[model samples]
Target chain A: MKRILIINPNSSEEMTRDIQDFATLYAENEAEVVTAKIEDAPKFIETYQDEAQAAPGMTRLIQKNQKHYDGFLVACHSDPNLDLMKEISHKPVVGIGESSMHSACLLGDRFTVISATTGSIPNKEALARKYNLGKQLTSVRPLDSVTGAVDKLDLCERVSRDAIDEDGAEVIVLGCADLVGTSFELQGRIGLPVVDGIASGLSTLLGFINQALFISKVRRYGGHV
Target chain B: MKRILIINPNSSEEMTRDIQDFATLYAENEAEVVTAKIEDAPKFIETYQDEAQAAPGMTRLIQKNQKHYDGFLVACHSDPNLDLMKEISHKPVVGIGESSMHSACLLGDRFTVISATTGSIPNKEALARKYNLGKQLTSVRPLDSVTGAVDKLDLCERVSRDAIDEDGAEVIVLGCADLVGTSFELQGRIGLPVVDGIASGLSTLLGFINQALFISKVRRYGGHV
Candidate 1:
């Protein structure tokens, strides 16, 4: 069996464990699913500054384990430092954001991303364009109800429902790695596919490993490893 | 079983049959793959003029059969009338070009397209950009060597080799519907993933059918059918 290493950029062990449980369950005997996070990184990666601060530790982790794993998944919805990760690894590095968006595009014409905050909306939209999924994205709705009024999970469900009724989203993407465990429950309530980056990322990387697909190392991804 | 209508958009019964055979084989009990072509369309879809000429017949066919098929696959690599078709149909319409590029993105970082003529290069590049896959595209190489000296299949092999060596392509997308049957043989020789849009499109539509995923019927795809 092949091995795939999934990295959550934040230093939150709780979130990392949640991602691991979700990944292991979704992967389900396809391959061994291993999860890790940047120990020196922020507990919460809510800003561009946090992404930058997380980069060095994340890069070191990827470089150290790139050869040990058949593939890597940068399991963050913002896909922090994804291109740089790909450049340094010979293995296929599937970003959670790209996987979620691309999988949603395959399953539906349009998808709405439910984010942790309004600040992450532009980041998701820009990544969607970069990945060629801009047209398929309906909108990015953030869970701004962080005032401890509604349960966070309930807020996600409400935002997803609104996105479906108003934004015409045929699919929903969980835009934060910490929300990785809510996909199935949310999909059931919203009556649309709710994509989790961790699940889709693992599934995509497994496909690549099955097909023996790797990053192009001739120019853009060359010389860094 | 779910039915997917794959339209060739050309007046060549032979090519339509070729696509049908390939689709039927690849689909393999997942979904019923039905293939057709415009009786009034050009014998070949080599130029934009050909696509324009083929549009009406293709549109009529899709409109007539939209209710019968659970999904649709626009089999030509140019994906002629794709947006219009989506606007008209409630079911999901999977474009071959879109499928090929998106699947390649999921599998690898970069892909090269093999087109039938130099005239189609711009079309493919533009489509790639429109699909947000322009950056992942290494380059488009046309089979302008239709000088009748070498075999067409051999020309494809040589072009693909050049693309891998010079363009740093990790994957190859056959850019014309006519090239659909050549993917496996070419992949064998090239030792890289050569994506046949028909197969990927069929696979994609089947996934949608299984998930009960449809085009969002609220706004962009609302009230068309």
Candidate 2:
């Protein structure tokens, strides 16, 4: 069986657990899932500074255990240090953010991303364009949370409903790592395909393994072995 | 079982047969595969004029059999008159081109489209950008065909190798309907993920069916219903 290591680039143990559970369920005996979090990293990767701070810790963990895992998945929606991970590890690497976006296009004609902060909205849009994915992304709607963190399923449901009714979003992508299992219930309520990053990323990585599809070492990632 | 109608806009009955056999195998008894080709249409959809010529016939086919199929798949990589079909048919409609591009994002980072003629290359590139799909489209390379058609798997193998070595294409998409079932053998020869639209599009359609994911009728497609 292929082994997938999910590196959650945050200090939140609860978030790590949530990511792990969802990935394990998604793998469904097809692959083994190993999840970890950077204890010294920030509680949440909401800012560019947070992503920068979490990079070194994730690099160390990946370098130490790269051989044990067949594939590597960066669990945060921002995909902190994803290029570094891909360059260093010869195995296939995918970010939860990219995975969710790619899966969104497959699920529907147009999709909206529900993110934790409005600050993240631009970054989410830019990331998709940069990767040349999420061409069908209609909008990235921010959850109007008082705490400015991903906290409630009710809020995701409401925001997703708006995205559907207002943004012409046929699919809803939960753009925070903390919102892993909320997709199932949210989709049921909305009557549309609602996807989260962790499950989507894991499934994409598994598909890569199933087909013997690996990262191209031709030019962009040729710096590594 | 969910029934998917593959509308081959081209008049090539042999190409339609190839699509049917492959989609049935990929569906794996999960969905019923029904295939049709417009006999009055052009033999190949290599030019914009051909796409325009075939639009009326495909539109009539979808209109007549709209309720008979669970999802509708336009069988050419160019995805001729796709928006029109979606506007007319309320059920999910996907172009094989759109499906291949979305699936490529899942399989690899960078992909190259191996088209039959040099003339169709620009159209393929534009379609991906228009759909906001295939952000990682490294290049669209043409087969050096004397007949200016999709023929000979050997030519596909050679061009795919060049795409990987020269263009950094980790995945090779056989960007023509006639190239169905050619991916497996091509991947074996090149040691990379080689994908075709017919199977890729069918699997994506099935994923939509599995999730009960339908098109957004709130705004852009709201004119019909």
Candidate 3:
């Protein structure tokens, strides 16, 4: 079985557990997926300062564990240490933000990102620029919810739907890792593909590993070598 | 100086000259830009059979020439042999379709792609899926121009503006390499960021190389034999 190391660059073990459970459900017999949170990483990264603080801790974790795993996934919507980690590791590494945003494009004709904060919107835009997905993005909307950093799960479902109906978002990406399992009910309500970044990252990880295995077999037959 | 090897995977010497002239204009003073066309490669690949015939020729060229360049750019809008070439080349390789469409997202809130043939809409979609930019795309429309696959420079300005106005395209991307040098003027008329894929690819190459250089610098600071 292929092994995937998912690093949540925050101190919230509860959020880490939530993502781990979801990965366990979907990873199937195809792979053995392991999820861990950095003990020294910050809790609730709400600012660029928080993200900056969290990067070195996450990079340290990736450096230590990268060789043992087939791939590494950074489990933050902001894609906290994407460039730094991709540089250090030879294995395919994907951030939850990059993977989910990519998946949202496949599932919908257009997409609107429902991020945690207004400050995070610029962070997302920078990501869009880095990955070159800014044009595919309709808008990066901030839902006016302040208290739910990691505890509460409440937001305007209607506003998100309007983004789909009026603003032309065929897919809704829940831009928080803590938003792992909550989006399915929203998908049921909105009647459009609402994506959880954690699940999408896991699915993409599995796809990448399976693709690598398939290519390895083909290379054994005098291909791509 | 950063070195870019821009390869026109066709036998058209005229197109090669056009691309070389275009690349020279935008490339930085610290960059060395050069171009070559496959003398034995197919001319004007307009259909799948033509593309299929051309892929091997292009692959042969990549195998022969990829070693000397820091970056490789396939100077065709169709982006023939894109994935296969990336798998083969150790250096950062980009195709105009891959680079421009990916770059389009960086320039605006939403964008639409205008290709040369009706069949290419699906081709564009496939590229979107491959690169994970499907969500940011407004639409991929084709201009059923019977002649001059993408060099209809005069018509591009008018059609591209219409696409931006009618389709809510905040950014306009010149989808074909033949439209490369002309997008800046069209952007002036359209009043949005216009992306020529060649420029986009060149920029992306620099971005990737810069990241690689940073990583290499970090590596060099540590103990090395």
Ranking of all predicted structures according to DockQ, beginning with the best and ending with the worst: 2, 1, 3
- The 0-to-1 C-alpha lDDT of every candidate, in the order given, reads 0.79, 0.79, 0.67
TM values, all candidates: 0.77, 0.81, 0.50
Better of 2 and 3 by DockQ: 2
Q: Candidate 3: deviation at residue A224, Å?
A: 26
- Evaluate every candidate with DockQ and list the scores: 0.26, 0.29, 0.03
DockQ of 3: 0.03
At residue B46, what lDDT does model 2 achieve?
A: 80
Q: Write the per-residue lDDT of candidate 1 for residues A75-182, one digit (tens) a residue.
A: 888999887887787788888888778877655568899899888888888988877678888899989944454776789888887888788887788889888777
Better of 1 and 3 by lDDT: 1
Compare the candidates by TM-score and give the number of the best one. Answer: 2
Residue range A1-225, candidate 3, lDDT tens digits: 788999888899898899889877766554688888877768877677887888888878877886799988888898886666655665657678877775554333467888877878877877766666676677777765443544334463755755766776766788888777777677556655576787766655554443231111111111222
TM-score of chain A considered alone, across all candidate predictions = 0.93, 0.92, 0.85
Interface RMSD of 1: 3.6
Which residue pairs clash within candidate 1? A132-B132
> Candidate 3's residue-wise lDDT over B13-53, tens digit each?
77788888988877755368988777666765556666777
